[model samples]
Target: AQSVTQPDIHITVSEGASLELRCNYSYGATPYLFWYVQSPGQGLQLLLKYFSGDTLVQGIKGFEAEFKRSQSSFNLRKPSVHWSDAAEYFCAVGARASGGSYIPTFGRGTSLIVHP
Candidate 1:
């Protein structure tokens, strides 16, 4: 199955601290990588994506990730934390399947707890 997995279900980060959320994917030929953030049950906002070129990709809201083909991993990182950043983060894989559009397979999700 073309899927993505996020091992961490929950993470707590202090305000103004650093943050890193891990992500791994199972896909052939280096699928599109994306990191999305959602507030509770709300819609997901695309944080970043790695489609073709650059191994190191930057995204909105001061986030960046590196695609490591050898390790089959794309990890999301942020230099500093904000209380508003507290939300559920999901790693996804976008792929074409049998004439259907390339859609994302989301992770179970990691809930970020920002402590003030």
Candidate 2:
């Protein structure tokens, strides 16, 4: 079984400061990793993903993540944070099923709080 873990429950950062959200996963095989953001009372939006090829992948909203096979981690990073970036970020790991469908296992999520 595969699982995702987000150690930080909450993080507060200055409005213009850089941000890094941690994500770790456990899986027997090569896992499909994803990062998603969710505004309050809104649905989750896909930020980035790593299926194969490049270990470093670019994401929307100035976000980027590097997949480290040695550490089994996919940490998200933003050069600068904004007020609008305040939201909940989730890390998920997906496993392929018999039908080739991906089954996602989501982490609890890290809440980003932006301050002036």
State which candidate has the highest TM-score. 2
Candidate no. 1 TM-score:
0.94
Model 1 Cα lDDT, one tens digit per residue, 1-116: 68888999999999999999999999986688999999976999999999999899999999999999888899999999999999999999998767866878998999999999
Clashing residue pairs in all predictions, respectively, total 0, 0
Model 1 off-target regions past 4 Å?
Answer: 98-100
Q: Quantify all predictions' global Cα lDDT against the true fold.
A: 0.92, 0.96
lDDT of 2 by residue, 81-106 (tens): 99999999999999998897998899
lDDT of 2 at 56: 96
Best prediction by lDDT: 2
What's model 1's overall lDDT?
0.92
